[model samples]
Target: MRVLVTEPLSEAGLALLRRDFQVDVREDLTDPEALAAAIGPYDALIVRSQTRVTARVLEAGERLKVVARAGIGLDNVDVEAATRRGILVVNAPQSNIVSAAEHTIALLLAQARNIPQAHAALRAGRWERARYQGVELAGKTLGIVGLGRVGAMVAQRALAFGMRVIAHDPYVPRERAREMGVDLMPSLEALLVQSDFVSLHLPRTPQTEGLIGAHELSLMKEGARLVNTARGGIVDEEALAKAIADGHLGGAALDVFAQEPPGDSPLFHLENVVVTPHLGAATAEAQDKAGTQIAEMVRLALAGEFVPYAVNLSAGAEVPEVVRPFLGLAERLGALCTGLADGALRSIECAFLGRIAEADTRVLTLAVLKGALSPIVHEPVSFVNAPIIAAERGIAVSEVRSTVSRDYVNLVALRAETEDGEVEVAGTLVGRRERLTQVLGFELEMAPARYMVFLTYEDRPGVIGRVGTILGEHGINIATMEVAREAAGGLALMGLTVDSPVPPDVLEEVRGAVRASAIRSIVLPA
Candidate 1:
């Protein structure tokens, strides 16, 4: 076996690869074409964030069985292209947990004790003991925004410092937070209102892009401190700067930014703000762990053993091309089910029915999880950790395959059970287009759209007209509608696509007018 290393790696990792296979270190293959030309003979490739594993590059690796990322993000790699080629991509997520968690504490202590400002004042040959007086962490409240890997660690560490720890994570089970000895707030607003210090440990997703904007920052208790050791963009820089300037916030500590090497920003000039160059994962121990992890995974792939860190671990080597097209559909169904389930998720079960069931559908199961949790999670949910995240929250996941797809080439049905109720959604691919054909137990047909309305109503005279009339009355334009029912005067399901999102009050009016059994406004990006 042969392995190619396109970027600098720890000697510990290189030694491991060299022990089992021939190794080539080529740090000059920054060009995609150059990397592709040199990749044809290698069975494995390793890189950091610098290399671009494009589709053409993957195609050039004729013997490639694995692509390993020695860091956290895979932005430089084309994951979908590799999955289609039956290649495995693995990364080490655990490598940076402690580093980031420790950094969060460092920043929190710095802000609380005015360490940076005090140090700067003394360095200028001035005695300023009285001017640098700071508060103590003991008896203070530390609120964690996301209780994932880093956030969990922060809670444990903060508790040891005699700080009251409260958290807010919807996907995490209440029992889990209790086990950690942390109080989980019911909502972000609730946490903000009571916290003396707020720390963010969330990803940069559309839902979380401006999570700590003006409105959220305004909800914080007066003179409250803030810390961000997670991704940038999760907090609005402008809002944070204004809050500090207005004396509404005590101070802030930031390690990441919305843009790397950010241009002139107001946060930099604020004396109360402490910023780092995104060094959350910068530690010798972290680098060594990343290298060792990727090396072990590459070896496992070559030996045909199970590789747990693989981005497509659920995808078996025998997954057929016919079933690949429906992967997106399955994810959409899962996403839709979660959006309507209403409460903390408990379990997920997806069944593969019809001719497509002949092949293993295990790989497609992650897509369902990705869709279901992406809507609410603060991190990028991937095939690699979706199951892990589910397990951490005590959520059960199972996949069943049946050789009966009913009138279609293949059908995927997914169900998500939450604390409130169970929501089931199923869909299938028609030609190249994927459409949802079932919601709950109704046989409805509709394509996934950015804006939609899912409702159940009595099958009676004027019900359909009444729905349309109520929507029009509220100036909500219906783009399209699909309806299916059991029988005359029986219950019916209506899936409608609208020009824009249906406001809560408007949906309530429609629900009241049509006497809906249940109604939910859904948004699924097309």
Candidate 2:
């Protein structure tokens, strides 16, 4: 196997890759056409932020099994195009968290003290101490927008500075925030209103792009500063400049911009604004970590093993024979549980029971996460980034192994705890075919399908018939149906797999006709 390195990588990483595979370092392939020409002979390609792995380049690499990024962001790589070509994409997400957190703190202090301005003045042989007067961080409230790994670290550092930390992350549990010695606010507006300084640590997703705009900045406390070290395009640069210029905000600091190498922005002209050329992960230690971590990931991908940092691969490169049959079942169960769940999802637990528990079930857990998050999140969820996406949304995920199974030889159970209540869905393989075994503690046998409907209602003689009638009237055919009840005249659960999606109005009509307490129409991936 041969691996190609397009950009500068740590010598440690190059040595590691050279151990098993022939390695080639070509730092001059910065042009897309040049990369495409040189990529044909390589089995794996590794790069940093400077290289753009375009679709054309991926198309030219016929032997390419994987594309590895030494850093966290996949902005430079065409991930969707690679996935379509059955190429694995991997990245080192944990390589730069500490570096980024420290950089955020450095920028925060610089902005608060007007360090850059004062230093420039002193270098120019002038002294203006009063003009550079700055505010102290002690006794101030710091609002964190996204309380993921980097945000959590920033909170700890801020706490040591004697600053009160408040955060707004709907996906994070209040208990978790309390343990971090931080207060979890009910909403973003609430945090913004009380915080003396606001910091952003969110990913650049469709939901988060331009997250902090004019109105959001306007809501901040007067003279409150803003810090962004997470990603470019997350904060509205123009709005931030106006906020500082209008004197509504004391100052702002940014390590990233909407466009890299941003030539001239309105924010650059403002004396109160501090900017860096995206140096959040520029430390030597961070580069080494990123390079070494990505090398290991690429090696695993080449050896047909499970890679924890894979970005596009659906499942592990290798799977135990015994546990292989349940991979799809676990994902379907995850999607089912998520679909049936009500209110906000707080936590998800995956339990591997009986014989399957004996095998390495980490890939199966990743399958569940991918299934649970794919329907809701804006970006595509893969076996690798599922857990990260869950954490970002404050959704807790856990897994357990149990050798004991009540009935089936192997069972995969997915339970989702929502704000309203908990919903559990369990599945098993029946002679190589996936089947739904239990839902919400009600056990019934039914084959999983692309479109399904579940209903909870009072156990009555005609309730099931009423549901069937409504679906049939709408030209929806039921492929399979199962009903489970506690006892006579008790609460009952009915599940059905249909030939096509049941429209919402039709579901509503069925709900009313059957007088069902709850109903969910789920459309799972084929």
Candidate 3:
């Protein structure tokens, strides 16, 4: 096997890669064509932020089996393109929590003490102690947003400094909050009003971009300070500058920005603001950890084992053999239920029945979550990270086991509770094939294929015929069909596997023709 190292990495990581493969080092390949040509022969590629794994490079590497990033973010890699090519993209999400948490606290203390401003003043040949008087973190209230790994660490550190810690994360369970020894606020507004300092530790996503804009800043206390070591773009820079300029906010400490290098921002000239060059994960320990972890994942992936940190796998469960065959079914069931679901997910319950239920099912349960959230979350969803994502969304998760089954020897049932309501899907393995056995409360068995349509409508005659006619008119062939209902003139669900995805116009036409209560297309990848 061959491995390519395209950027600076820890000696520990390089040594690990060298143990099993022929290694090449090329940190100076900045040209895309050069990178594309150079990457063709390597079986695995390892990189840090310095290298961009472009689509051209991935395409050129016909032998590439894995692309391992040394850090958490995939902004520098073309993950979608790699996924399309069936290349494993893996990262170390656990490498920098402590470093980022410590950095956030460092910035918080600096902001409270006006450390940067005072140092600058003293450097200019002035010892004005009276003019540099600053507040203390002791006896202050600290509010944390997005109580993920870093946020939880920050809470612990703040408590050690005698600061009262409160948090606002929609996804964190109240029990988890209690375990963290922090008060959880129901909303961000409530948290900001009660806090003397606010820190952000959330990933930047469509929903969280500019999360703390004008109105959000206005909700803060008059003397509150802000800290961001998470990502940029979550705080509106323009709004932050205005808030500081108008005396609405005390100050802000930033380690990241909406734009790298943050060229010509008004906040740069503000004495109350302190900034860093995004050094949250700059510590030696963090780099080494990230490098070695990513190296190990790449090694496993190259050996054809399931890498727990992979971004594109539908089934990452490493359960026993008896339970392994059902992992694909579990994942697909999760994805199907999630697509059919409405509103934000609130909870997920994984129920294992019959023989497989007696075995350990933690991995199976996580597969369900990974499958359900992969379609919706901006962050990469995997069995290793899905529980955290669900917690971040305040979604409760549980696993249930039963030794009895009506038909199959083993069955996996997935139930999702969203803001709207609950939806249940169950599946089993028939010989070597996975089969969808139940939906809602109706029971029927069918091996779900690649492309399918799911619909619920009034259980009356002519509805099925109208749907079939509409699909036929659109040139779609039904490969298999399964229908279920509780009573004669009530609601019924029909799932039909088709040769191709139905177009929007055709689906709309079918809905209109049959008066479908709900209808959508689902693709279960083989």
Candidate 4:
């Protein structure tokens, strides 16, 4: 295998790649046409932020199995295009967390003390002592916009400076915030109003673009400074400039702009404003970690092994040992829920119970999403694009975890809300085998197979026999079956796996014979 490094990478990473694969370092391949011409021979391509892995480039690299980014973001890479071509896109997301957090603190301190202005004034041979006097960080309230890895680290460091730390992140649980010694604000507006200084540590998504606009900036405490090291366009640059110019905000420090190499802007002339050329992940240690981490990920991808940092894999990667056994169960349950759904899907909720909930169940959740989408969509659905597809279809997805299990030692459940009603399916791993434990509140144990059928009818005798008779008449073989009831003759559910898919007409006949309230024939992936 051969790997191409388009940008500068750490020598350590290059050496590691050279151990198993032939490596080529071409720092001059900055142009897209040049990269496309040189990419055909390599099996893997690695780059930093400078290289743009366009669709044309991916098309030219017929042998490329993976595209690796040494940095935290994939903004320069055409991920969707690569995914379509079956090329794995991997990134070192965690390699720059500490560096970014430290940079945020540096910016916070710089803005608070007007460090850059003071240094510039002193260098210009001006004695400006009282003119450059700044406020102390002690006793100030620091508000974090997103309580993610970097935000949490920033909170820890700010606390060390004797600053009261609070945060606003809907995705973060309240207990998690409390454990971090930070107060969780009810809303962004509330956090902005009370915070003496606000720091942004959020990803740049559609919803987050211009998140802190003029109105949000106006809500902040008078004279409160702002610092952004997360992503560009998250904070409205024009709004920030106006806020600072009108003396509403004391100062602002920006490490990233909406556009790299941003041309002249009004914020450039502000006295208290400090800007850097996107140096949040510029530390030598960060670069080395990014290179080494991405190299290992690429190596794993090349070897067809599990890669924890792969952003586009549907399975193997990111699944913990305990959660690995439940991936199939989760996906099967997802397919079952969708199969049982009566109307258009509106939302999906994945609940993890028992010991499995203690692990990082993201991969399992992704499996569920992939399963839910694969059956209905015209295009292919993988773990990498399931979330995106769900969002595009306006389907809300959520995950809930609990360490306590009511019956099984571990359970993965999927509840999908549709326009008509909701359908729920739950499953668990039983000694390396998958078993369906619950379906729409009906509790029964049955192994899931490639072909399965579920039916709801009156708890009457011979209902199961009649269904079996119909299946037998249609030449459908029942592999396993289970019947659960709410009461003696009130309502009951029959679930069974078949050796072959039950014909649609045969399923209808069975439903009519048993007078089933609901019937669904589901076909799961092998």
Candidate 5:
């Protein structure tokens, strides 16, 4: 297979790809047309932040099976367009964990110790030891936000520095944080109030944008410093600048700005502020790791094997063992409702209960969107792009967090209110050690494998046999089937596991003949 590696990736990442395919390595591909034209014959394409895999590039790469990013952000690539073409997109998430974590720590130390000011004063031939006096890190309290990979690592390093570290991450397990010797704070306000230094390691989202505004800055101890090496716009730059100018806060060191190559910001002129040109991921070690990881991901994608670090891995074709077949519960549930007889969706709500609630629920939410929107859109869908896709299609999304669930353990419900009306469907994580679950409020629980037919019909004695006969006649054999009913002759749900994908035409035929409320063809991971 031919693979195109665009942008400067590490030699290690390329070595893995080179072992299996003919490789084209280019440091730049700024011209979209030229890149598109050259990428047509390649089976896989790899890129960093510079390359743009637009619709043109996607369409041109007729044989393209995968597009891998050497870094975390998907903003550079057109992920939705790729998904529509059934092209797998992967990224190296763990490769840069250490790099980012270390950078956050470095910025924190620089701000706390006033290293930049001290160095500048020394270079200016001024003894100024008293003026540039710094504080010791030991015995100070460090507050960390968003306890993902980077946050956890930052906590570890801060603890080693003899600083008491406390963190606030709604998603992380309390036990895990305790094991790491990091105090888990109840809220952002609590962390800010108690910390001598506050650091951000959160993702960029609407909820997180400007999260550290004037109100939050006011909560910090007067002399507390702040550091941000995560995404730009995560902190209110304007608010921070005002706080510093008014002597409300001590100082700040920012490695990222709301805008890259910032467009004339006041923070640059401040003597108390230390800024870097977004160098959090600039280390040679990080670049090499990200590149190598993407290369390995592409190798697995080409070979039809599992690729970890996929932002949308749970939603995509590759399935891991822990969740097993239960992963498909969200996808199938989405498919059952997206294609069903309903009005447009005014709002979409997802509920995570029991064990599934304990795990990362973000992937589960995206999986539902993937199965629901795959048939309607023309591109590959992703977590980063899922919300965007829904917005464009005029759908509202709402997620519910609850642990008040038992027996079924984890339950996912999608409610769609279209022009026709509003309809709600729910599912849950079920089955034994191997992991199987029921989707779409169905009573049926089966191993998550490919090609299943989910049918909603009037509860009746002969409906199952009639549906079975229709499938058998169409050369579609049912591997397994289970039914759930509200009451006899009332509404019922059935999950039919099949050997092959039930073609759309065949599904329409079954829907029409059986007079069922809905019928959808679904493929899930095993």
Candidate 6:
């Protein structure tokens, strides 16, 4: 395999790839056109934040099978375009958790002890010791948002500092927070009112953008400090700047900005503001770990071995010796149920049966919840806080375990009930492959490929013909089609696995033509 290394990664990471592949290193392909041309002949591409993997780059690499990011975020890559082309997207989400958590603590301590300010004063020959008064972290309340891997690590460190830690992640359970020595606040407003310092650790999404704005800042106590190491837009920069300038906020330390290499902003001129160029994952250890980890994943994928970190695909319960693929199967089933359920989900029922039920299967349950709920909620979730997340959303979830064998070796069934109706999706592990076996009792088996279209209508003699005619007219060829109905003229479900995705407008047209009761087209990980 020929692998292209587009940026500087650790030698430790590059060593793994060099062992089995022909490696090409190009540390100066800053020009998009040059990068595009060079990438055409490679089987894999490795990059850091500087390089952009656009659609043109993917198109150039007709032989490309894997694109690995040596960091947590994939904002630099065109994931949608890569998925459309059936290319695997992999990232190391946990590689930098410790580094980022320690950095957040370092920034908090710097703010409290006035380390940077004091160093500047002493260098400038000003002996103003009284003006450089410092405060202790002991007993101060630290509020954390997004209690994910990084957030939990930060909470642990803050507790070691003798500080009282409180958090407001909508997805973390009360029991989990209690175990971590954090008092879970009901809302962000409650956390702001009680905390001496607030730290942000959320993703940049439509709901989280400008999460800490003027209204939220106004709710905070005067002289309270703010720290953001997550994503830039999570906090409203202008509002934060105003709060600091008006003396309502004591100080703010930001490691990320809404804009990379942020242009002149209101926060730039404030003396109390501390900024870093998005250095959350800047440590040597983190970079090496991320690079090596992603390199191994790419190697496994190219060799047809099961990759544990694949964000878009799963190999089911039976695969190269690991903690069973049942966990991944559960997650995919959760995502499927969440997609089909209507209205807001009020409850979830997860039942584990056969061999999977007899083992310690907490991870499987967590995987299912994370896959199912991540799309609808506004917080970062993991196996540790799945149940807590459900509780916070006012959704009750129940788990039933049984050892009786069923049709498959391991089966995970997820049922969600809402105002619209109840939808149940189930999946099973068959040998080395993971197959989705059932959807609301509409029995069918699919490979869970990246692109799928499901339609339910009255079973008629010409139904399949009409559907095929419309897709052919739109130039969308059917790769595989599965249809199941109880009886003639009865309710039927058709699952169409397509070679390429059906455009939104084309799907709408199909829905109109069939006069269908429900039509859902989505791209799952293949």
The full ranking of all candidates by lDDT, starting with the best, is 2, 1, 4, 3, 6, 5
Tens-digit lDDT string for candidate 4 (418-514): 8677788888888998888889998888888988898999898788788888899888899989989999989998889899877778888988888
Q: Name the top TM-score candidate.
A: 1
Per-residue alpha-carbon lDDT of candidate 3 for residues 394-512, written as tens digits (9 for 90 to 100): 77899999999888898898888876778888989889888888876678898877677888988998887888888998899998888888789988999899998887689889989
Q: lDDT values of the candidates?
A: 0.85, 0.87, 0.83, 0.84, 0.74, 0.80
User: Under the 3 Å rule for N, CA and C atoms, how many clashes does model 3 have?
Assistant: 4
Clashes of each: 3, 3, 4, 0, 16, 1
What lDDT is obtained when candidate 1 is compared to the true structure? 0.85
Model 3 residue pairs with clashes: 171-391, 171-392, 171-393, 171-394
Worst ten in a row by lDDT for model 1: 311-320
Whose lDDT is greatest here?
2
Kindly list the per-residue Cα lDDT of model 6 for residues 113-149, writing each as its tens digit.
Answer: 8888888889999987898787889999999987766
For model 1, how does the per-residue alpha-carbon lDDT over 1-526 read when each residue is reduced to its tens digit? 9999999788899999999999999999967999999999999999986789999999999999999998776657887788888898888877778988999999999998889998999999988999888889999999999888789889999999999999998877787889899898999999999999999988775567788999999999999999998878889999999999999999899998888768888999988889888788788998899899889988988988767677665343434677768767877787788778767788999999988888877768877887777666544466777787777767899999988766777789887777777888888888989888889888878888778888888899988788889888878898899989999899888889898878778888888888999899876734
Give the range of the ten consecutive residues with the poorest summed lDDT in model 6. 314-323
Error of 1 at 198 (Å): 1.2
Q: Write the number of the candidate with greater TM-score, choosing between 2 and 4.
A: 2
Candidate 6: deviation at residue 146, Å?
1.4
Kindly provide the TM-score of model 4 when superposed on the true structure, using C-alpha atoms. 0.66
A best-first ranking of the candidates according to their TM-score comes to: 1, 2, 3, 6, 4, 5
